[model samples]
Structures are given as C-alpha cells and as structure tokens.
Target: MGMLCGMAALSLVLGHADARGDAPPPAKKPRLVRAPAAAQPAPAASPEAGLLRGPATVPAHWSRNHCPDSIPEGAAYYIVVKGDTLWDIARRFLGNPYLWPQIWDKNRCITDAHWIYPGDALIIPEVNVVAPGPGGAGAGTEETPAGGGPTGARGPSTPGQILFPSIEETALQCASYVVDGREDESLRLVGSEQGATKVAFGDRDILYLNKGSNAGVKAGDVYTLHHETYAVKHPDSGKAIGLKIEVTGWVRVILVQENTATVMVEQACADIHLGDYLKPFERVQVPLVVEHSRPTRLTPPSGKVVGTVVDMQDDASIAGDRQIVTLNLGTANGIAPGSLFVLYKVMYPSVPTPRIVLGEAVAVAVRDRTTTVRILNSNDAIMNGDKAELQ
Candidate 1:
C-alpha cells in the first residue's frame, strides 16, 4: 500500500507540471512546394521592344500623321522643308522656274507665291525633266544657238518655245510716262468724303470732281488720274522737252450733278490727292514676250539710237533689276514698247576703253521724247545719267 501511494503522488506532480506549460516537444519543419513553370507570371516587356519591329509594325497614329500612304498618279507630294520657294520647287520638278505660276494655279491654298511655310504639303506637277546643268543648279537646259557661246551665256530667247508674260498688267497700267505740256486741266479731283482728315486716298474711296454734266461728265465715264511732277530735260541738250506726268490712280464717274460729279476710285497706284487732273482712260496692253538672256560680251551696239537714263521712278537716283527708269529717247528716236536696250558706261571717253556692259532694260512706255524702261537685269546699280542704247 505504501508503494502504490508513492506512485500516485508522483503522477499527480507530473500532471501539475504539464498543466503549468513547461517546455514541449519540437514541431516538424514545413516543406516548400515548387509551383509549375506554366503557372508562373510572364516577364514584363521592355519599353523599346516596339521600336525593334519594322516600320510596317509602327503605330497607326504616328504613320498617318507623318506620311501619306499613297500619292496621286502623275503627281508627287512634297513636304515643304525649310528654305523652299515656289521658284526653287518649280525649277527642281517642272524644269522651269517661271512655271511657278502653274503650281500656284494648282494649289489655290497658297494665296501668295512669295510665302510658303515648312511642313506644308505641296503637289508637284511632273513635267519634262530638263537635263540639269553643272552642279545640278537647274540652269537653262536648252541648247545654245549656233553663235551663242554656252548654255548659260546671255543671248536671245530660244526658238520654238512658249513666251510668257514678262510684266504684270497692273505694273504696266501704273507706269509713269511723259507728255507734252498740253493736258487739259478742266477735269480735276476737287474733294472727297474724307478729304478733311486724309491727305491721300486709295481704291474704293469716294471723290468729287470739279466738272459735271455741264462739262460733258457722265456716269460710267472712266478717267485716268494724273498730276504733273516735273519737266524732263534732254540729257544732252539740257533743254526741257516734255512734262513728267505721274498716274496717281483711276476714277469712274458715278453721278453727275449740274456743276459737280461724284466718282469712285477704281485703282490707286500712288496716293490720290486733291487737284489731280483727269483724262480719258486708255487701256494699257502689256505684251507677252520671252525673257531674253542678258548680254555678257561687248556686243556691238545696234546704233538705232543712244540715250541716257535721265530719272527713275519715285525720285530714286539708283535702280536695280526690275526697277523703272526714264530714258531721254522715245518715239522721236524710234523707241517703242518691248524694245530692248543695253546699258553701258563709258568710264573714260579720252582713253580708248571698251564700254563696260552694265545691264539691260526693256521699254514699257514710250512717249514723244521720253521712254519708261523696266530694268530686266543689272550687273551693277544703274544710276541717273547711265548710257543706254537700243539692242
């Protein structure tokens, strides 16, 4: 009985110890299971991966914005780059720079040929490909004539080619000319609606004339507005021959009262001022002619008649290419419109020196003793008193 009681006491002590949370047996470690390869998440792609693909795989938005998929037949799309002009484009594609007007005609969006911006798409008209000159500058590719020196040398226009209008019609209409001091001053511009505030008038302005129904003025009658500038003297004789009459603008009578007439300004080349005289309006016909190459050599003078550049338009003393100048020779010297003249300078009359070829000009308006010429080309600045001879 003593042994049994001892064993019972020992067992109770062990139970009490276990209940008090003594150190327990260690737990088994968990095994990490590998996921299948197919179940793994895919790796992310690089940002530049799309660029590795060809242009065909490019995004639709980018390709559409950059270029057209296809252009029209017989025409090419030219994305205007910096430093591009209609003249340069025409010469590059159409073989002639003067054909720039054709391009302007085709692209009505280009209101002014003088202005073109980069990135603006232009339609290039395909024409005969002129053989490019040396350095591919698109110089005149037409073969030189028998006696003409080379392709780029100055000479007459090539035969069997079309002639283009060299001068604009408006330029011809506004050109100044000379007349004998015999113009009738009976009809004149007297006042305007804005005459009190404005000293000059332009197109679409209303004006009043001094003459009316009593002086034979009628509605729908067009008159040229002119004013006497100064007397043009002969360069050689220094004698006054004719008056330099400047065409300020044109006017058309709208209503005629007993002693006054109401008129509207049709075109204004210069400022239309009060006291401007009026004459019967004559339509000026500008000629269509080939622009001849400038003469480079010491070509013999035609001896038709020699003259001097007395004055330039707008009181300018120096003139360059495309500037208007007045010559002392005119109808009395057999000078006529469209006539070509070679401008030369005799540096030393005493020394036997060849006349230096300065430039060339074309007569646009001819009067009795004076002619107005448009300088076609000038190697140097042409000034008053420069010598000119018919070519």
Candidate 2:
C-alpha cells in the first residue's frame, strides 16, 4: 500500500522514542516503610548516667573515688600507754589482732579501736606495695563510702590517679590522723621485697627487706616476704625438718628509714627466698606519742598521788621525787586525778616478744619485761584486805 504506510510511520516513531528513554520506573521504592526495628527506643547502657552496664571489674582508674593523699610520704607513729589494748595493740602491731581491720583500715585517724585516748597519737600507715607485672604500681586504693553508689549518683570509690611508677604517692599507712593501733611502745619493721617469689642472691636478686631499713623499719610497716606454709617442726623434737622453706617473713611497720624502710608484703602466698626472716611484730611498747595535751597551765597534784602502787619503783617522776609506798587494789584501778603509777616488781614472767627481734628495742630488750618501779598515793588512805600492793 505505499510501503504499508511507510512502515507505519516508522513504527510510530519508534514507539515515541522508547517512551523518552524510559527512566521514570524507579520512583516506586517508597515501600520500605520499615518504621519497625521494633519501633525504636533501646539504647541506654552506660554513658555513665548511673553506670553499671557490665564488665568493669574495678577499672574506673581503680576505683576509690579519690580521697587519698592524707599524709603518706613515709609515716609512722605510736604513743598511747597504760595497759594499752586493741587486741594488745593488734597483737603488738599487726602480726594479727585479726589485723584489727588492717589497723582500722589504716587509721583513717581512728574512729574507734576501743576509744583509744591515753595521751593519743597513733598512726602507722604506709603500704605502698606494688609488684605485679610490667612496672608495678599498686597500693592504697580501698575506699568506698562516698554515698549512694550503684549508680544512684554518688560514685567514686577509686577512679583515677595512677602515677607512681617512679614511686612517691605512698598513702595508706593506715590513713593517718592517729587512733586505731600500734602504740604499746612503737618502733617498727613492716616489710617488702615483693615477697620473694624466688628470691635469689647468687642468681642476682638479693632484696631481703625491700625497704624497711632492715628492722629499723618505719614508714607504715606491713611486711610479708612470705613462704611459711607451716610444718617446719623442731620446737622440741616435733620432727619434720625440710619440706619447703626459705624461712619466716611477716612484717608490719609502714615507714621508718634512717637506713632503708618501706614494707607491704601483705601475703606472698608462695615463692620468696633470699635470706628471708625480716621479722618483728611490734612490741616497741611506748617510746613516744604522748599527745593527749590539754593542760595549758593547770599543773596541780604534785602531792595528790592516788593509790595503787603496792610496791614497785625503779625511778622516773623527775619533776620532784619522794619515793616510797604500797597498796593492793585501791580506787578500783581507775585512780585518776593526776594519774601516774609505775610501781612494778614481779622480778620476772613478763617478757615474751621474740618473733625475730620483736619490734626491736635495739634487737631485744623488753625481754624479761624489765621490772622495778614506785609511786602510789590515792586510795582513801590506801588499804588491802586482799593482796596489799600500793605505794
């Protein structure tokens, strides 16, 4: 017909140029109405707003919430007197009066270790011990009373402040302020040496008392140098001589160094042997710490001396001197009103300190407990219907 209408007008102009290149069909993806990853709302773990999401063992810088630095640069004190007792002063300076709460948590200035008051003055902190792996920097951190933790918003048990690889931030010598324990005669010996996990001198190690100045020990006394799993017998043919030993080690005087002192050794558990034996458990019993001062000028009672001295005097009341007297149990032992009694003469049966030079009174003096004393003048005319021991 005219070439079939000229191929139908070139097939209708190639179907209108293939519908203008056909690209408008992709505009239909709006079906993704995925407004349902379960309807949103689920992202609140630990931005710290009450933190506590999971796995944080104690890593908020080690968590103590920060409060440290209360006098740690090498501390040691011990004064109190008159029959002193906090389990006998933590069994003579922390050999274990059950540790007296580690000296009442290192003294925090003593809240109450039986009211400690006799002239006060008692701190013995210092436990800087850190000997773990790579550089070792651990000590002090153990607080937890900021208030309302558990995410309520009172946090800070120990969170930040590590600096001590060079060693100098040392606090914890029982927290200072004095009060908890260590005053039945003070001079210390605490310890360190990382507790000798295989201590050696021939192998090239030689550190028997890391820093307690070899018993002149002071600076918070707290030794270990451990390895006493028991069973070394021989106190009287008990048997069993050699099984596992480099011998004893258990110190407790935080900081004291006229030579070299600084100990912690809480408990080495195992491995420690380089001539071990850094002993002494605290018995220096009253060398100085008489800080109960309050008599700014009230000095009275030069002759009022209450009774209790049933005979025992060696000499020491030097403000004047007029010795001679005796009584049994007058004034019920309270005998205050100027209190001062020394009269003691048993001759023997008082000395027991020997755990490696006991707190060292020059290595060993308080031995037979030393005796002989005098001075007693208060007892309503002092009488003794029982044993008679007053002066």
Candidate 3:
C-alpha cells in the first residue's frame, strides 16, 4: 500500500513538470548551434601568367563600369577589352597616362606598348602618383618630360630601342657587291676620285664619269656601280640562263658636264675600280618586322634554292647568328626585302626534297638579281655553298 502511494506521488510530480513546459529542459533547444563558414575559391590564373609577377590585373577601364572609384589594396587583375590602352589604364588607376611604363615593366607579356591585344589580363599595381619632373616620368615611364629637363631627345639612348639597323640603313650601307663583267658600251668607269688614277677606290673617293648631262645624268643623282660576274648555267643543259652581276659600289654625282661628271663614292661594298659600270640607283627601304614564331595556316612558300652566300658582311668565312650574307636570289626571282628564307644543305640537288634545314635568314636589301640577307638564326655554320629557299 505504501509503495503504491509513493508511485502515485511520483507520477503526479512528473505530470506537473510537463504542464509547466519543463520536460527534460525541452531537449536543450538544440543548443542553437551554428555551422562553420565555407571556404572561398582562389582566383583563376591567366594565360600570360608566366610573363608576369604576382597576379594578373586588368586596366582601370574595367573598374569604370564594374568597380568602385577606389580599389582595394593587394594584388588585382582585370580582363583586357577592346580600345583599352596602357595609357588609359595609367590615367584611370595611377592618375597619370605617362606612367604606363610602370605597368609595362610589371608585365613581360607586353612586348610593345602599341601591340597589346584584347583578352589580355594586365596587372594593376598600387597607385604610385609621381610628380612631373626633369628627365621624364621616372624609370619605366615614357619619354614625356615636362619642365626644363631634356626629354629622351637629348638624353642617353635607351637600349633595345635601336638594337638592329633599319632596312633602309642596311640596304644603303651593307649591300653586297654584284660582280658584272659583261661589257656595256654606254656605262664604264672613266677615272678615280680627283682623277688620282688609283687602280682601286672605295667610299668617299671622287670619280670621273664618261656620260653626264647629255645622258640625262645630273648633279645629286645617285648611281649603282656593278660588274658582270658570270652567266648562270642551267644544271640540266649547261646552257646559260642570264649574266649574273656584282655590285661594286654607289656614287653620287657632285658636278655635271655635257659628257663628263664628277661623282663621289657614297657607299662601297667592294673596291671601286676603273672598269665598274653605273646605273640609276633605286632606293630600297623596308621596315624590320621580327617574327616571334612561324606563320600558321600559311606554310612557307615553295621556291627553288637559286643563290649562294657569295660573301659575308663582316668578312667572316662562316656566317652565324646576326651575320650578313649575300644571296643570288633577289627581286628578279620574286624575293624582296624582309623576305624570310630557310637555309638548307643538300648533298645532291637532284633529289626532290631538301635534306635538312640549317638555319633561317631575312632579306635586308633586294636588287635586280641579288639580295642582302642577315642570319636571323642558325643551327649550323652557314657556308658559302649552302642553299636557301623561301620560307
């Protein structure tokens, strides 16, 4: 009877606790637990990342549309868009368009200020506003001198800006001599500079000409001197195709007479002699365009190996990197200045295919039947007998 009474009392106590909403502390309300924060993804790398330091950043032009006026600190990047320039990026980010060099120095993919293409993600560093001063905008800045400092005009020359000679300069100064021995009735060297009677002459020497005003030649007229080398023979028939000529030198007429004139040797590729011949000079000029890679979809054009390395510009027997060489192929064979050719050495020309590619060259000057080429690159020493085909 006591046990029953105790159980009844306990039941009554539990029922009262439930009515007061206190059952086992309501399961502790799940402790209102919170979950951990999620991890953020890292930024994607750029295709030109190898050429740069830190992360790739974009120009401020991108922020004009999408970002706030003030950018956060630390590494940033931007996708390149059409019409965006380094100058514009500098002005937008650094508050100075002349400071584009700072961004350029930070990016190696930007080989040229004028050549950045769309889709390139440029790096944007922190704003480093520099006051205009003498000299220029500072190192890595463009040549925009403000106040009294000499701009790049009179300052020390910037390296890499003039590393290679222009095509016009090379053509005028470094063209090879074409040997022309065939007798021409009208064109023949009469005498040396100042009539010194020297057997061989060179640059800056004055010469006496046989034809002047009567032959439509006048003072200040430029002429090319050449000599007949030999007639090129057909490999199959041993028949002569054409007479190959050699360039002797160039002359500028200073004084003119009815049948005689005083000419000055402007440039001499070889020794100017009493028997050299002359014709009106044709100005040759072509801008140098360095190719980073071979053209795609456009395979190298097919052409015959028609020339030999008659001579080297530096008088070296074997030509290598950056050496100048003369080839028999020229405008007459559809070769022009700036034309690229692949050098090859085939033991037997009778074979249908080129045996091996030795190197590459670029034409700096094109004459009637010859061209002056500079070795762009080479694997083997370019010898005199190595053949070259259009690339």
lDDT of 2 by residue, 246-280 (tens): 22334344545556654434433234444354544
Model 1 lDDT vs. the true structure? 0.60
Tell me which of candidates 1 and 2 scores higher on lDDT: 1
Expressed as tens digits, the lDDT of each residue in 197-302 for candidate 1 is 9889998899999879999999988888999999877655687768888889788889999999999988888999999999987655333344446777567764
Q: In model 1, which regions exceed 4 Å deviation? A: 1-159
Counting clashing residue pairs in each candidate, in order, gives 0, 67, 18
What is the descending lDDT order?
1, 3, 2
Expressed as tens digits, the lDDT of each residue in 1-391 for candidate 3 is 1111110111112112223332122111111111112211222334353223343334443121232333234445555455555655554454434334456655545533444554565666553321111222111111111221221111111212221222334233435444334546486688865565477888788889888789988887778887765555433345343555567768888999999998888777777788788887653332233333532223343433345565565456788876777776555455555556677677787777635667777776766656678776787788776766654
Model 2 stretches astray by more than 4 angstroms = 1-107, 111-115, 118-207, 210-220, 223-250, 253-270, 273-391
Candidate 3: C-alpha lDDT: 0.52
- RMSD to the true structure for each prediction, in A, is 33.4, 33.5, 32.2
Per-model lDDT: 0.60, 0.26, 0.52
